[model samples]
Target: MPQTNDPFLEIRPYHDEEVPAAIERLVSDDEFISAILKYRFPKLSGSFRWLFKPLLKQYLRAKWSKIKTVRDVQMNVASYMQSMIKNTSEGFTTSGLEKLDPNQSYLFVSNHRDIAMDPAMVNWCLHTHGFDTVRIAIGDNLLKKPCATELMKLNKSFIVKRSVKGPREMMKALGQLSAYIKHSIDEKQSVWIAQKEGRAKDGNDKTDPAILKMFYVEGRREKIPFAEYIASLRIVPVTISYENDPCDAAKANELYRKQEDGAYEKGEFEDIESIVQGIVGQKRRIHVAFGDVIGNEFETPDALAVEIDRQIYKNYHLFPSNYIAAGEDHASITDTDRVLFDSKISSLPEGVAQIVKSMYAMPTAKKSDFPIKQ
Candidate 1:
């Protein structure tokens, strides 16, 4: 077990020593077992749950029995992710991988789209290209259950305390988070975190300067310049573009409801629904672009955020569907592109349909307005 007094005990991922207990804990949870079976075999949910539960639980325990470390868990799930990508996406491609070195560690700041797949895609790209998988940053709010929490930690995901109360506790949490991120990189383990706290529901992908400020929280204690401290972390901006968002329709519905009501309330299971939708829905093509590390060039958090945004905007891959939906001339679009765009927006209500179009078109518009810097 980890030392009882460890400062990071509240937020860190499960250590190798704690993996066995986590596995056991997750497998024995009736809610988790039922959820997984229902997700994997929805047709068998109502009357067949009794028959499916024991078999599924046995299979899960057997699968997790040999997993005694984080890497073991990742290696086991690697094939499952590969299969998910193959089934859900038409094709997956990566760019700017040559700019990275396997021996070095980086803080990969990515634009978040899907709750689970954003970091999963980045990790898959690195692992397939002969690099170590990154430690993912996930929010505590997503861990609605103990089993869910254990599963994420077993997959090398550390929790970010989003629900902490009071300024003192918040500051303390951020300091510990900053220290943990720095320590991971120093140990040659890369880290993947979103540019902001939540997904850009409006399709605008901008880095929050507050996130950048948090990175300097611990570094400031060492009395280092902001630029030097950021440089030490080797921050890289990542851009992931999906030709068709797997949850575009769902996101549009949420956007419309939020607009209609002063405040939109989410059901307890809304995030879980989104997670499942993102994994199983069709994505035409997905592209991941890795930008060069932002070294000691930016002296301020705003400056750093701007540079990261620029990189993401410049590197974002725009599909023909994007152009078509943005109301570009249909004459220039190919037959396949026009057909794809038509089918996507045909069934939606007017408001939701417009939101979906804007979601896909925003990246194209942003890229067009900004010239790529050499």
Candidate 2:
């Protein structure tokens, strides 16, 4: 059953005849799905279509396409990602792949800005470079469906279990996550992870030291640091930026919730809503900037965190919107090597201004700043 907030989630794949039998009953009976879809996809729907006019059955088949192997899943995800970049970017440019050594494995960490496009853009970069690319670190909270589950796993996404209830449980999960991440990298493959758990809502992209420390709690508990374990894997910073975010409303709600409730509860509904917003929301020309590869062998997580932020800022691609926002917000601009702010803005049309502004507004030098400038 779909939650009242989003009727779209409730509309799973179904045959044509089954529409009246399976899907239509919801719109006729629920009212919420009817009201929301009518509001959102009005182009595809008609007045009476809500009840008896019927929607196309193709969308159902689209979700359940086909997935039998990990390879199939990987290509599907890559191309699905490629389609978004090809379709969304008015003009896209990438730099710094030559800085990455394909022969070596890297622990790729990046700033988290846009939820939907970060991993997709990262994969696009690696694909274009001919590397097998990365196994991404995704939160279990985002795996809301079978397709999402298979897609991430196919693309080498390991889940960080967010459901642990106790400190002891949390410690165990951290150790397991550490081992899995190290194993993936030691095999000469790279892994992509946001510096934080979710998209840095509100455009703040700072690295969380706690996440860095989680990489070694197993050794800490045993009276020895996991430097040996960490040394075996290479770490790199990737900076990903979207020309615009498709989910600002969701990001804004998160900022509001943190201010009001002291925390945000990303319930199943919020996850579904974010995913919906990720796909259907309007996004203009997205760009993912690649940062330099780094050595993950570190003395401490704090040191690693500091270095991560440095590398992230080093690779940040500034545009006109960021310059303008920084000027307006009185935010300090420290890095100005890539492109001049005014010139960057001059490159965009009015339609792309909102996106450029959002990217510019991102928190500098943090994982919350979705530079994906890992």
Candidate 3:
């Protein structure tokens, strides 16, 4: 049930009017405070935070006292993002910004690589290139805690219903999602969503037709052709490539477990841990390429998906690490590149090493050797 008569109230990000209360609730939450202390000051928090909970609470309250709007939240965190980019990555490169019209809103569909970094990178690119930051689509699975939910919504991330059980509920959720996306674009707000539900652990990036179909679900209520509806949305395909994944070892282990057991179960805080690792870990180099918008030229979801996949693969920047994993002699790689890449995977166990190698290599194969589904 929504708190208001607005149809998207349940799933939409918090409004400007609600930012103050959401921040207050988040800072007051024990789970959030504990998570923050553990994330920011893990070494001393165990002994210090527990001993001085009141002091911690007072500090947080004063720090976040002026965060009364969504933009304020983004501005507050901008420095942290810039610092991470400065320290962790060699550099960030982007292409195709000149292709986009700044005044027009677009639906950016990108291949998911890292849980939080996928959208964060896209948003960063847009923000840096004089475009508005996009409203991100985040799954409900990551919003299990009240503090997590408030923080995400405050940062302009809307929830996607991933755990809906019944078919009817699933359909309803998708419909609402589709409607909200269309509404956002119509209102001149850009949106960022993954091409699939989860990150491609093995690095073979492909668009899921189900995700594309959801885009049409709400638009079909107007009795228009699917192609026309899709064209109206001005959908843009984006691809982001990381030279090195921060949670590569964890991702490899999970993939190996799935191969061995045919399924894998995740711990409750696994995603949060990955988020922390991704923020702090070394990425070496990063590239984001935006592709041309798919207009009335495509009629079916499969066709559209193939087109998106093609752009993603074609624009994916290959680093020395990718070629090294593929067992190719990199006559082009500098000495520093070789050393940095070697040190990244030097300590991995044999089995996980193979999985990590394949993860980096698959994108190259998809682009050159093997073709993704037609």
Candidate 4:
């Protein structure tokens, strides 16, 4: 993993000048950067942090009162999001969130494009439509970073644990997540989760069947039908795009290195760097588009899964690469189109071919061509 503290981590408050140097050393170790961040900055524990409790609680209380009603919370959240996008990025443009159903809770399953913008834009879109906050699922491994965990919690994020090494542990974690989802929806709220555990590079955004299976734990020989359990909460598939995802080249490198080996070598610092780059890197257009909603009104998990996948893939905006890549065997676009694109690539500098191929992992020729459900 890339060390995030490569002089950049010094941006945050540092009690000592040596703090950055130590962070650099710690981030460079064999251990995951997350483990390092956790060890160095563990979550507030026991009574020692009580020193600041009064002050922190006061601020939180003030923030809470300032955001009393659901409407207040939504507006506040949108303003915060808007300010963030404006400060760090060029600007964001979203379409289709107005189509969201406010009366009923829906599962906002989306393709993971930009890390920060994906969830932020989705929540902002929903908020504009007067919907309640959506619970977001982020990896527990990520919470090890000092500031990030606090921010995620503030924004209604729940952890997705990756350290469940045994089936028993995994089942328990899955059950806990399921129950949390139930709690959120029962309260007439929505949840947004990536279609898969991680972002799809190479442009394939298929929902993992295992993820779908994990969502239906309550249906086996129990009081609820699997279909009803899912239908009870509406699942609205959404698609997001970044004209330029800052991490695109990094992602391509990771994917290529992973293909060469089995996985990419990354530590917790890589996540930190990714977070920072995502927030501060470039000026690009961000778009959040909503797709159709799929519900338990269906009869089975298998059917529901297929339907949801169809919906999500439909809304995916396949940029040029996804389009031209298909021309190899797809008759919709002429080979002339592929040759023309390749000719443009040929004019680029050295190693551009490799980079281009990696960058467009799943680049789409067209984003609007995904299938619409019957």
* TM-score, every prediction: 0.97, 0.69, 0.95, 0.69
When summed lDDT is taken over every stretch of 10 residues in candidate 4, the lowest stretch is: 7-16
Q: Global lDDT of each model?
A: 0.90, 0.61, 0.88, 0.62
Better of 1 and 3 by TM-score: 1
Model 2 ranges off by over 4 Å: 1-67, 144-147, 218-228, 260-268, 280-282, 328-359, 362-374
- Model 4 agreement with the true structure over 60-79: per-residue lDDT tens digits: 45555444333454466687
What RMSD, rounded to one decimal, does every model reach? 1.5, 9.6, 2.3, 11.3
For model 2, how does the per-residue alpha-carbon lDDT over 1-374 read when each residue is reduced to its tens digit?
22456322221222223333332233233343443555556675465554532343344334434543445556766777666666655556777788777777777788886665677678777777887767777777776655455334545566778877898988777877776666566668678888987777667677898887876664465566555545555667777765446665456655566766899777666666666567555455555666655544568877777777777766676543454555544344435512445554556554354445454565342333433432
The alpha-carbon lDDT assigned to residue 236 of candidate 1 equals 96
Q: For model 1, where is the 10-residue window of minimal lDDT? A: 324-333
Off by over 4 Å in 4: 1-77, 87-91, 297-302, 318-370
The number of clashing residue pairs in each candidate reads 0, 31, 0, 19
**Order of models, best TM-score first:** 1, 3, 4, 2
State the lDDT at 70 in candidate 3.
79
Tell me the tens digit of each residue's lDDT in model 3 across 208-259: 9999999999878888898999999999999999998998899999999998
lDDT of 1 by residue, 184-234 (tens): 999999999999998988789999999999999978988999999999999
Clashing pairs in 3: none
lDDT of residue 243 for candidate 4: 50
